[model samples]
Target: MSNLVEVKNLCVDYITFDGPIRAVTDVNFNIKKGEILGLAGESGCGKSTIAFSLMRLHRPPALISEGKIEFEGKNVLEMSDSELRKYRWQGASMVFQSAMNCLNPVKTIEYQFWDVFDAHDMVSNREESIKKAKELLRIVDIPEDRLFDYPHQFSGGMRQRVVIAMALALKPKLLIMDEPTTALDVVVQREILQKVYQLKEQFGFSILFITHDLSLMVEFCDRIGIMYSGQLVELAPAKEILQSPYHPYSDGLGNSFPTLIGDLQEMRGIPGTPLDLSKVPPGCRFAPRCHLAKETCHIKPPHIHQQNECRLVACHYPINTSDNRDQLPIKLTQVAEV
Candidate 1:
């Protein structure tokens, strides 16, 4: 498939009296048309920062330092206010991390849906908008009778579904979902994601799914990009990463989650705390925590290279070496065969 969005050399910084604190640096990736591309990492790894940049939602403190955000061949950074106003909801939309935060507490659910129509001049007739609103609500499994109810009247899961309904209100070509199901129960989370995956197939829109759960992402997304200290350390097919990860950090992240079919084992999360943005170390950002790091890893930055036609990694000593290559792949293959 062709690319729907291309983000190249992206760097986002937060300005302070001292200097710009780089939150996300040198990130590059593309979301293919009708594909679900996921960004996975521990908290504060710049996944949200990159999402905000795509929407130009950064406030005064946060700024895009250097990058090109190209969406559908148009430069997002260069769009005028009017163009952006039209582009945002119609071309692309986002379901923010919190559903409660996304909805206005004082406004009725119908008004929340109508407000979007008002902003883009999508509809002037209230009855027609109401009809459309009911359809959207139904898609997310919300009752049409609840359309006039306030946000607080609904449960957390219902509110999240409402937000999902709003994000798809415009039939946007791309949808950015940032931690969309974090606040919900596991069953609700799975149900909502199933609804979204069904909607993706029905509407044919691409998705940028951001989350910390590598296991969940691997199941939901077409490809997974693992982030560390604001940098993209690895990108590969979801199953490939699960079967045999290339980066040490990616391997470590895979080990953090458990498998239902396997014998219970201790979850070995990546060792050490995340890097402090204010005082970032030189060379490879993940070198301090990576057990495979050699002398060169601490002295010079590892260059991002294509590990295969479909995989990319930024590591001096990737785990997929000749000596140990395909070890996990064979195990996973056997599991699948069983």
Candidate 2:
């Protein structure tokens, strides 16, 4: 598949009166055409920061310090305000966390869709815009008549579906869904994800799905990138990640989710809090919490090493190594210097 978006050495920081807090550090990943790439991590791990930076949506206090964000061969970070305006929504759209609540309380659903169409000059007349809006709503299993109803009239799930419809209005090439199902019930979340999968199949658009749900990501996404302390520690096929995680943090995250087929025991989450970015510890950010951490791990940062053509891991002593009998022998190849 062709690459839809490429993010390299991406770093983001929040400027405060005290100093700058590094939110994202030296992150690297890509989303392929018609592929769903999932970013999973705990809260404040910079998953959302990376999402916002991709679309140049980071407001004051948060700023892109260094990086390249390329979408379809165009450099997003270098685009002018005018270029950005044209690129956003039309090129790529973001379905933000709590997006269902983003609907204007006073405006009818139809008006909101019209506003999107108007902003992008997508329709010639109001009737045409409404027609497009109704089709979008229908795609999400919403009735066309609801377009005239206010935001409060719809249930939370229905409102979320409406937000998804709005995001798909332009048929963007890339869709960034930042915890789109965070607040929804399990049934509603599953329904929404199914709808999104169907839409992706129909539209052939790539997706960047961000959430803390590793199990959900394993089920829904083609590939998964595990983030820790503002950096991508592991990137690999979702099945491989779920079955045999390389990074200790990734293993911890995978274990944090309960398995349906395995012994239904209590889920043990990763111990220790995430490091403070402002006063980041030397060497590996995860070294302090890693059970397998060695003296070398505490003195030098591990470079991203390719385990195979499709997998990358940044860890001095990854889990499931040859010493462990459960996994296959992993051949490490240097991909990039840290």
Index of the highest-lDDT prediction: 1
For model 2, state the Cα shift of residue 103 in Å: 0.7
In candidate 1, stretches whose alpha carbon ends up further than 4 angstroms from where it belongs are: 323-338
Cand. 2 TM to true fold: 0.94
Which clashing pairs does model 2 show? none
| Model 1, total clashes | 0
- Ten-residue segment with the worst summed lDDT in candidate 1? 329-338
Using Cα atoms with residue i matched to residue i, what is each candidate's TM-score against the true structure?
A: 0.95, 0.94
Predicted candidate 1 versus true structure: per-residue lDDT over 165-268, tens digit per residue:
99999999999999999868889888889999999999999999999987788779999999998999999998888778888888888777677676666667
Clash pairs, candidate 1, are none
Instruction: Please provide, for model 2 over 260-315, each residue's C-alpha lDDT reduced to its tens digit, 9 standing for 90 to 100.
Output: 66344566666788898888877899998887788998999998889779989998
Whole-model lDDT per candidate: 0.88, 0.87
Please report, as a residue range, the 10-residue window in candidate 2 with the lowest summed lDDT.
329-338
lDDT of candidate 2 at residue 172, scale 0 to 100? 90
- Stretches off by above 4 angstroms in model 2 are 323-338
